[model samples]
Target: MTATSPTPSVVSSVSTLVRSPAPAGLVGHRRAGRSPAPLTTGRARRARRVLAARRRPADRDFRPDIEGLRALAVVAVVVYHAGLALPGGYVGVDVFLVISGFLITRQLLKSVGRGGLRALPTFYGHRVRRLLPAAVVVVLATTVAFRFVGPPLKVRDVATDALFTAFSGLNYRLAWVGTDYQHMGAAASPLQHFWSLAVEEQFYVVWPLVIAVVAVATRRRHLRLVLALLVVGVVAASGWASATLTPANAPWAYFSLHTRAWELGVGALLALAAPRLVALPRRLAGLAAWLGLAAIAVAAVRFTDATPFPGVAAWLPVGGAALVVASGCGPRVGAERLLGEPLVQCLGRVSYSWYLWHWPLLVVAPYALGHALGVGERLAVVWVSLVLAIASFTWVEQPVRLLHWPTWGWIGTGATLGGVVTACSALVMVLGPVTTGTGAAAVLASVDAPGAAAVTVAPAVAGTGPAASAATSAAEQAVARTVAAAVGTVQVPSNLTPLPQDAADSLPPTSRNGCHAGFTAVSQGDCRYGDLTAARTLVLFGDSHAEQWLPALDQLGKAQHWQVVSWTKAACPAARLTVDNPSLGRSYTECDTWRDATVARIGALHPALVVVSQSENVASSSVVPQAFSAATVATVRALRSAGAPRVAYVQDIPTPGTDLPGCVATHLDDVRPCTYDRSAAYRYPDRHAALAPALATASVPVLDPAPWLCTATRCPAVVGNVLVYRNESHLTVPFSRWLAPVLAPVLTTTGA
Candidate 1:
């Protein structure tokens, strides 16, 4: 979404627009009473005369066009977040960056001309007054609201995100976590929209300092030229970085100020060239403005979530915004008149507040209402957000901005510091303990829960000797005890394995040690696990689905005395199919390359048995189950051909289709609500429906673990005191470890 902290009266005072321009930073001043006198120092006069000579027939200080652009940008963001049809609507953020760059830089330039950066305190004070208070209010409100609707784990995340947002470092936090998906499998943070505001605030930190340096280093006559060169340098360098990093590192490219500075630089360049731009022919300027609007429209309509953002595609909206601003150098014309309309101007006036309020409502409303919102419901949310935005603007943003206490910037800073402290307190209270508790074995033993033993108790050997029969009976009796223990009213155990807050970090050792490759890495990278010195070798292979099974295999390997070697990569399936990588926003050729190399490597190892598992949900919609089944067959045959004496496909686990940890936390007293229907979990995209029969025909032997993890009709998120799944699909490491005994017999019978 797009957002910029606008000057207090930029659009709110539109009714006061006049032909005679006010002081540079004093346009549309209604609450502040009288406008400041125009800068009249010799240098300021010279600069004014130079600009006045190039001005068009009619020019005014109030830019209704800019205000209208803000409204358009904010509306696009709100619509996009509301799950409307605007896929490319996020470009509005790019437009906002440019606007912020232009306006803030122009103000700084005026200060430089008038008194050599002497108004720095006042400049900073105005910014702090304009942005921080509203941001802090929205962040606090979102965090408190989330505590009730969101699960404790997710609420803790929201609080932590709020803490970062309060200090204008939410962008950095998001960059570190990669949108909380690649690492945690958590829901989108309610405060995620703060990243843009953080970017803008960060820009303010550096841009003004650069202007001061330029003003100090250069003579007054040469100041503009030097600053222009610096702005161009920033644009080119940051633009290149954005394009280069987006392919492999979209989170960093999208959120980092270093990559996004160029959009603001483009605005600064426009402000620097304002005089020459105003001198353009009226007809040409009108055409340029129309073209700019079309460019923004095209980007908004054409882009999708899959687009690698803030790269080359971003130029479309950034340039469009710049052209719009350049056109505003003269009089309103063509599309400018439409942008300057009263309604649009009003939207622009409340745009910052609207942006701050919209995302959290959109994110939190679904859970609060206990259902995904339909279009009508979503539209209702948008309207409610609008009302909140207007209220916030009228009451919070405006009043704080108009308050003129001496050392107000310092007061704002202190208030921001207090907000940060408040957020930290919320974070600590919500997160509670960071412990994952005991392992599954300890938990199952102490709680007398069945765990995998509930299903592993097979029927007694019908024809076996007395000793064998007695052993079977003893096993049956042990399972009986497990059943008895599991029969009581199920409540969340005090010693829950991988406590809710620590669930996401409960990964297997392979993941912790970097054995599983990330998206960019093609090589499997030293992924050997479980008794590396054992004579016989077993290979475990595939994507994160395969990685989830590593804990079981690692435990089984030590018990059975075999070397377990794993080759896993994020989002890369074992099936030989061209798939899309959402993070990279393109075909995962790296997966193909990694698969080819891994298959070759497995062939050379000549493993006794190869175990394969992959999440079926990863394939793009274009990839039919038939094709996926065929690809699975090809992969199995290839593994055998590569000198794997035996190959077995593990039935992928039942996906709960909801955040399991969150659901568990929400229903700590009763986890039945977190259960998913058996048939649905094993349906088409699961690959088991198609691939199981296909593999059976090919004699590859698909081992279904469904019985171990599910009952006949449903799979509970928590099974016998162990949190079975970390997220919707992935197994918690503790649960994986607990399944070792049950999984060992089935895997061993495969004849490794």
Candidate 2:
């Protein structure tokens, strides 16, 4: 529920703590069978050779500057997430990917050289211990905190995301949902940051097996060539997929591992090439390091959410990280030296925990504090994240990880831990947002219960009989009177009842069958309802705003012996004009194509009435109103050219900028906070004035039900104990159905 928009998922990382090297012949220097040499003659030289042969360079190669780079990456990520002025701070994830690839590949390559597949268990076990503890703690803490602080609507999603993160499948989950990372909105998941961690975890699982199989089983002479080819294939394939997929499916492209493999592959390439680069003259190496850092800085400053990601544009930061790694492979120089300073290195040590701790803190801070974070509050969140990260790294991540279990023990224990988190998420979903303590059932019953005068219309008579037993218009007005009397200067009962329970269900019936075309739908599909066999048919045409009136139209059609059809798509108006989709970050051409197709279908159906309506908020904003007169006139003329009989236009309802379910849930006792001005409803001149051109040009009569929902005073959140609008723009099915009587008289009088 929290993810209204997409941001990248939180990534978990293994701590790269570089402890100070110990004295000669320390614990790691001597092998099991090796003996230390005494400071004697040829015997001492032989012992020294033995000790040198047995020693592993893994500890000695631990690069503090790499840790500093990590620190910088996480800092960019955290600051960017806090709404700080880093448009390309997300590039930090790219940096982390490169670094992880470089370090992990270096480790795996070394292991394969030394012991081939034999070192795999140790490698995997070390990995499990390195990442599991902090991940578990953060996920569990996030789950618990969200349940307590966030609205119930967000609880299930956060739990599911946490579960996905636990299994390193969050990227897949996000891809499935088509989560748009950039501009995905403010309600993004607290555990959204876990997605990157999933990628790293999966890479950790795979890279070892590939290297072990190639290095241990095959000839050492061919290792570099084999890996180079493999890395190239990964980079080429992933980069191609990223380029192809991003335009149509940004979320999938943004989150999918297949698309991101290239960034990491670039790191592996750099790691393989590091020895060559590090052997370069110190002057060139220093220049390369500085250049890499500068590239990263430029990318962070210049790139934005609009920049197509993980394709060629992403090479800036990824290449930069690789250059820095190559230049610093031997010893710190230039930029590497600056990056290796004590404070930065310390931050690098705790960067993984910082990454884990920062996102959830930022996401839930608003709900916990009951308001959006100000600049000071955002800084406070950053401070708190640092403190928690340092604490967790010092306490949970370090001590427990140092225990070093065997391969099977690690695999078993980690899976069990993941299972526990998964089960917790499942339980949260099963328990749901509407439960006993939440009091949602009681609220639902009150809202669904019969209102004053029992506002129900008699069932539609079969075979062209009179629609309703009673005068439907009279019933509608009577229900309206009952509502007004029931609310004598007090909040309406409808707003308080059935809240946050059937909240998402408030959409029209068209939504159930996907009759309402989504943004990317190329063509409108056929959808029919109500007295299907009737000779006369009524078509509802327009965008989702028009689709919201399905309940009302369905009722009117059935009672009047008319079949009903809806050719509607979300945000696709009948008007043939370009409009900006802020969510898609582009002009919506799919809607235009689908809208034209839908109008053609309406013409083919040639129903008794074609009811048209659309939300006008999508029209481009300017100093003057975008009435869209020419486009509206063209669409109406097209409808006329294709059809016969009456065409009615339904004016759009008011648009409010608040989530009504959340507002109603929070202000259940006092619903006035959720109400909007009746005058403000008609304030938008684009759609309102746009209606005039089409009406005058095509001679279409208008059905204005705005008065029935809102009085002269204000438009209440609910009417007659049945909640009205679903969110801010669309009407609730129950309230829309209740308006059948009001619409019946209009349809009857229109000679349909």
Candidate 3:
């Protein structure tokens, strides 16, 4: 879970990527073979005080324990992402925050104590060398890998994320999309890990400027008190805000810098008191370090997804990290010794690179394989990420950071790489969906055309009475045979093409017109189609599944002289029943209200016909068929009593467990791997099954789209060379529109 604020997860991204892990051996070590100057009494004493005043603790007070701490944080994050344990492993990011604050603040105060601000060029150059090279390589490589592993739309989304990663603004992009990282039941952006990095970078960029101003204000006075108060003030206010805001606004509290400022501020304050902390007796310091470690351990194991994040809940980890950092400097205790081991230090050394590499691999691997990762596979993911991290550290990070480049050279390198990343991302956007490989296009051409011979399970012959019922079986069987032959004869495309050409903006026209009443909507409304002026209105109403039929409805209305009105909201169906929506993590009051008002609006319109559909996630009393049936009956009865002359309900299509397009891409050589068992799909409970008896009483017919979507024992991702769905359970407009010839007559049949 990355919000790991409503909670922010661990980082290589936004608030997570705090700084270059300085590592154990890099700090507190002098050039090899140099010896301390021989005793010089009075002259040495004066020089010692001068040097102390001139340098910050970070320059001389480096402890290997901090590196071990970094090791712990990154491991918690990795283990959590791999689904091993630690529901709150995301708090490792909060630990990183404190560590970052301590390091940066100590460095700044050292500069201040030395009688001036650190040279900006030198400071920025160091940061650039330490962080930029590895970041650029990772973002560039992730972008390239995404083109192969993801759907075209996903490729576009990841490209945009790559651009944001280059600029360190991925958190803002995620906020715009209302991304709840903990419950990404669908395809998630791999670069979502970078959101934490963005936050950390933001802190890095702004904190220095503020500290520089404060340093100037103190102007060589005893500035510790003033700085401590400033840090305390931020800690108090930001902590209070996080506690207050998180329940109602978790995403904002999780992602926003302001909400998280207190954790970092507290670490900075600890840095201000570093000398006193170090002055403590060894036994007490050892006790504190062990206790702090215990607190962190408890938090890692006990915290859950529902735990309100980064507010008061954060103190457990944040305070523990601060205590360990403060106490670790005093003595080499058992805790310190354990943390200082070679393996731990090595893990800490490559922690940043590991953080950067793990997330994309975790997100992309399962998608590439078309299945969820097992324990062994998850371990492989971690091992591969570790190998890549080691490569990044050795090849990109160490080599560039060790160089003695001039400040301008560092700046130039950063700018050139940044620009290249931006251009590559922009070029992907410009190129649009990669309409690659003429092979699929050729396979689709012969069978995908609207003019291709139309066939299906037929509708009833229109007549006055019993004869229509008698002829129904023959008509349907003839249509079924025709459809089966035509479908079986056509070549199936090995891979699906993300459709609507503008795949990234594939939302329906109603959504654009603000009438599709998504979960964000406050009220119900209508967006009309076909001949808007036509008197005989045909209304398509329900949740997004109903919206999927819009392409067909619009086509039918234009050709058959019926006006189409859409009344839909995401996740809200016309069935009046209490249901749980996991995405919202609540009863979904907004969806309930939208459905009530939408149905009422439909009644008011008194249209010639009303069509309704919903999702399996929706049910009457519960997620059961019988309950949905009762709910469907009650809803339809109300509509009929409210003057709905005729009504129809649609059964949802088969659920694709994985992203259909991504699956197809992974097995482009053959699509056999993408097919799912039809019996299992059909066995899934249907709301329509319960609705049928109720509808029969009211003369409302049921619409089952199964024949077009599945065969007797198999449900394939593709049919007649057209991709059926873009994701788990929604129809692509192109595929929906292609079904018009089969769906038209059935829709025109007036009665049950």
- TM-score versus the correct structure, for each prediction: 0.84, 0.83, 0.78
lDDT of 2 by residue, 137-254 (tens): 9998989888888877668768878878877999888766543211123367888888887888777778778887777556677787788899999999998998876765666778
List where candidate 1 sits over 4 angstroms from the true fold: 1-61, 112-119, 179-185, 407-489
Model 2 CA deviation exceeding 4 Å by range: 1-60, 112-121, 175-186, 213-221, 427-476, 482-499, 623-626, 681-690
Q: Mind giving the per-residue lDDT tens digits that candidate 3 earns over 1-752?
A: 21212212223322222344433332233458988678689768655543433332433546678889999999999999889899999989988899888887887776634445555556667678888888888888888777776666577778988998889898877765653311235456888888887887888787776676776787747577777887888889999998986654566678778888888887788878876664555577788898889989999999987777877899999989987887765545668888877678778878999999998898888868978899988988888887777767776887787798898789888889899999988877777454432234433332223343334443332223332353244333433443354334333443434542333244567757777775547585557887777779988878877888898788878877789988887777677876655444445677777767767788898999888777755553335777666777788888887888687777676676666655554445555676776666643455544555565665666656666666656667665556667666777776677665555555666631
RMSD of each: 7.4, 8.3, 8.5
Residue lDDT tens for model 1, 1-752: 11233335533443333222323422221356776567769767554444443343222445778888999999988888888878989998999999888888888888754456676777777777777777777877787777767656766677778777767888999887873334645568888999998998898877777777677767566777888988889999999999998876788899999999999899989888875676665676788889999999999999998878878889899989988889778644698788967778778888998899889999998989988899988888887777677668777887887776776655567576556757564765655433332223323552223334433433322122231233233324343344344434245666776777667788878777778888778995657778888898889999988889999899888878889998998898899987877666667888999998999999999988899999888887677878899998899988888877588777687787777777667666665577777778854544456777787667765655565566556666655666777777789997787766645544565666
Using TM-score as the yardstick, the better of models 1 and 2 is 1
Error of 3 at 73 (Å): 0.7
